[model samples]
Target chain A: MTQQPTAAMLAIGDELLSGRTKDKNIGYLADAMTLAAIELKEVRIVADDQEAIVEAVNALRARYTYVFTSGGIGGTHDDITADSVSAAFGLPCIYNDEAIKRLAENYARRGIEFNESRRRMARMPEGAALIDNPVSTAPGFVIGNVHVMAGVPQVFQAMLANVIPTLQGGVAIISEAIDCPFGEGDIGTELAAIQKAHPHTSIGSYPRFSDKGFNTQLVVRARERALVDAAAIDIRAMIAALQG
Target chain B: MTQQPTAAMLAIGDELLSGRTKDKNIGYLADAMTLAAIELKEVRIVADDQEAIVEAVNALRARYTYVFTSGGIGGTHDDITADSVSAAFGLPCIYNDEAIKRLAENYARRGIEFNESRRRMARMPEGAALIDNPVSTAPGFVIGNVHVMAGVPQVFQAMLANVIPTLQGGVAIISEAIDCPFGEGDIGTELAAIQKAHPHTSIGSYPRFSDKGFNTQLVVRARERALVDAAAIDIRAMIAALQG
Candidate 1:
């Protein structure tokens, strides 16, 4: 809370690596981190291997203020992220009583038995805190700087949103978008010039698939809304003049 | 083709690192590489800085069989990916003749003027072969093992699909999924046993957001469908018994 928090996201899944599923957790976390004024520094997607998860978690935890990981927290064989992270921190994995009760009660509401495998969801590293999962009761856990959560995009997102608000924020996000007909090269040099003119703003250009045609969406974001809007207006005028 | 085809994905943009964009490119490329039988060992997401792109491309090109980059190939100021790749390869980035012709023709059909900024899309490293873009006219290019493409998920995906058929494939994808009611801990020991039982199958468990309650989806993947299926059957039976 003293210094601005910077975070890293590690997405663990072989399915993601094999392209069986599009991992949307990273984007969801990124947006949430930005909104909380926490800087999202790096994201790594590694296969669900203990060594890989351990290595990534260690590296990110050392470099960034916090590490937010999604996936590999399940009861199945490959869900080794929590164990690996616990190992990295030299912490013992233990069953969290609070998490177990919460998950069991959630299942009881649906008249479903909280089986042994389901009970495994309650395990957390010693000295860890449980992250609330209102959408699903299998609570994400925080150990040291690493927060381990479900890989399911929706659930992971919900958990992250719930957690991020409790963290301290430094800046609010303000951005403006300009739909430009100009292709990249024609406006490349001038755009570069404009960026040099405004050192504080973060300029982004996203090429969108539009019905009208391939259009470039140029966005300028900053802590200040007026600066963002001004930059966008100027950029839009520059694109129009280039077309003329 | 002569060597074990290797590929790496370079995701460029501040949005990604800032947590404004959770990247979909790495997962897409990983799957595409696996299907192509190409070894995808590493993927790095960097800010849209020319130096960072050049350094990453150079480092990856030396170590990898292929380096495919996404983002920064647009008309805006942050669209410096093409230039950086050119710098890394020590190739002159010129307004590609064929690309210009295509852009001009494509723009004419859409009744839009081909402005100078738009012409930036035509710039490519000297001697690079253009990768087909079915969804958009802004074609990606391949210089040696480096394939530079768009950042937008849909466009990047379409370009990947187009490029994959031109490459060789490794083992065909074969997989099976098992639903587990048990929590991760109770099945952790048994899941390890199942993995040991079938060393060839890539067994993984994903926690899904479920209406009934939190459930784990266990998947086994291999070159042989029957082998994968057999592993999944064992995994399911084990999970069921363990939960009971």
Candidate 2:
């Protein structure tokens, strides 16, 4: 039997840590992965330090089928993602001849000087393939199972859009929700029982306070369409019988 | 000398791991902590499993000055954060009389049935103090340094707003950046020199592709305004001399 494709996301930036920036990348990529049927199993947010990036990449890559890393790929002093990824795999950092050629061409068209620092973007881990960045010329790359993308949301999303299409996917997961006016304790035991009976289905309850009263949101999820529907049916019935 | 207040973020949800949801809570809380002058040192995201939450809470709380958790505190079957935190410290889950009273009264105004499931939101750890949730009636709570908050962004933000103003903060960290038109290797040595010169400041070198070609973005960060400004100036001057 073929194993399900699993992914891990590593978000790197000190700005994220200091709360200077809100990371929108994780959710965007997560939704993208879900749409593509790639299961995102884990996410880690690490500082933009070389040691941390290297360690995280090495660890996550070995554990998951695919690893998607965002941030720290820019031309900033805080951007050390590429070098760290290379070091993590003991690969040499070298300029991708094709990337450099394209970058130089793009710069020429834009009438921008392909300065030394700007030219540095073409450098990537040896043997890695470039993931195109349409929003900007800075190309994201794939080294082994790790896909290193840009940090800026626009460029990152563009790169990811290009990268995800190339990968294989599994059955797309779907979800549904039912609002229950009852408290969680009234149904916690039964819900746990339902979960145990249907191990494949993912069930969750979210409680919110509305002007009418505090309401509980029971969410059901599954990779199989039938199972999700069945779970929702059972869940709605349980809530109705117990509360209504 | 006074030690800085530190905080860690704990995001609890299977939705996060499933990639169905992107976490805004951590980034939001991190920003709030920074604004309050607290140092956010670490963040951990665990699935909505009891053991996972308990283990994470126990481990993180001991290391950081405070642990703020979001998600899984709702009134759903998946909402086990309160119990998990309580279990971690061997505390019992009990309905807060005050919470139950308030919840009942609040629901009465709306003419909604205060079902048993909804009452679960009123459950608190034996000694937990409720953190006011202005956006919603289901209050967040604080036990020692661990603050349990709602997962919904608006509610979470409001809940955090209620808590942040009361916490102690330290000097706000600041940053500055300069673009260098050089490859990472070309300036690696000089960059090392800068890092050594400003040990208190964090210097990051990111290599990226720009319209001008590959450029490096060098960022210097420090808590002291004067030091950060000085480092930025020196960094720019060094890059200038390197390019020249």
- Mind giving the per-residue lDDT tens digits that candidate 2 earns over A83-200? 9999999999888998898889999999999988777788789999999887888798999999999888888888888987888998777788788886564677678778877789
Give the clash total for candidate 1: 18
What is the Cα root-mean-square deviation between model 1 and the actual structure? 13.5
Write one digit per residue (lDDT tens) for candidate 1, span A93-211.
Answer: 88898988898888899999998888778877888998988877888998887888899977897888777866767767787767788545556678888888888887776665443
Name model 2 segments beyond 4 Å from true.
A179-197, A208-213, A238-244, B19-22, B51-59, B86-119, B122-129, B134-139, B171-244
Q: What TM-score, over all chains together, does every model reach?
A: 0.71, 0.73
Name the lDDT value of residue B16 in candidate 1.
81
Classify candidate 2 by CAPRI docking class.
acceptable
- lDDT of each prediction vs. the true structure? 0.77, 0.79
What docking grade applies to model 1?
Answer: acceptable
